[model samples]
Target: MELDEAIEKRRSIRGYTKDPVPKELIKELMEAARKAPSATNRQSWRFLIVQDDDMKNRLQEGITQHFVANAPLIIVCCLDRHAFTRQLIEKRVEELIDANVMSREVANMLYQRKLPQKVEETGIPVSAYLDLGIAVEHIVLKATSLGLGSCWVRMFDQERVSEILSLPLEITPVVLLPVGYPAENPSMRPRISMEEIILGFI
Candidate 1:
């Protein structure tokens, strides 16, 4: 499907069919997410795909949205807090410089700026959250293009989900994405006018 069509058709699908999503399509979705850009090229996002019935039931306990368990697959989108450490950020910047994607002078300037010295000191930054959101949106759009349905679910217990999935301390779950064949076709949700959204074009 065309990108524009996919964007227009995409919706927060709350209902899904019993049929399972194909593995190949799932891989495509993951590939799209993998290619998403991140701040300073810190590809820090991680995804945990859950399909088992038992595990889905367990996950539903943490998620307030019960419809999430109905989907054939659940993607536990996460952020690797350790990736924000000065060491890792410097490494990524070096790679960018080597690839000529970023100038050495710019990289040096970035290094001079204050950043988290250790992983332990790295709290989840807002940019990291935005990065993960971009990746998740990639997945959602890919799903729509592939004739699948998905929803971005955040109304859930993050700590409980981490415990249920046995996630490492560094891997923090940020969003839950449920994917499958659509059982309901929802109309487009209301949006603010373009004029309202575009405050001023400088």
Candidate 2:
């Protein structure tokens, strides 16, 4: 299917059939997501495929939307704990000194002090969240093109879901996606016109 067709046809599927989605299709969706761009080329997003029924029920228990339990599979998108960002910042700071753009003392000071505070003070950095978003949408749109249905589950309890999945301290769950063969045919919702959406530039 064409990209525009997939975009227009994509809907939030709340109800799903009992048919199982093939693993090959899931892999294709992940491949599409793997191509998503990230800040500093730091791919800080990790995907956890949840097919265990017990774990899915535990996740659904924390959600008010019971329909999520009906999905044959749920994907947990996670954020990296700034390990790579910290390393990148360090490397760039040193490079700045090597290029004579910054003094060694100044680079050391920034690396020793300010850099450590960024990940801690910022807590779940927005840039990482933004990066994860690009990857997540790739999977969603790819699923649409492949004749599968998916719904983004963002309202679930973050801590609870994290515990249910046994995620590490460095990995934080950002969003959940329920996937299956859609049972309901939802109508397209309205969208703001381009004129209202865009402020100035074409």
RMSD of each: 1.2, 4.7
Residue 62 lDDT (model 2): 66
Quote the positional error of residue 48 for candidate 1 in Å. Answer: 0.4
Tens-place lDDT per residue, model 1, 82-187, is 8999999999999999899999889989989888987778898798889999999999999999999999999999999999999988899999999999999999
> Could you tell me every candidate's TM-score relative to the true structure?
0.96, 0.82
lDDT of 2 by residue, 1-202 (tens): 8999999999999999988889999899889888997754557788999888888778876676888877998888898666455666667566666777778777667656544434543356578788899999999999999999999888888887788778877788888888999899999978889989889975
Task: Kindly provide the TM-score of model 2 when superposed on the true structure, using C-alpha atoms.
Answer: 0.82
Instruction: Give model 1 RMSD, 1 decimal.
Output: 1.2
- Report the CA-based lDDT of candidate 1 relative to the real structure: 0.94
Which regions of candidate 1 are displaced past 4 Å? none
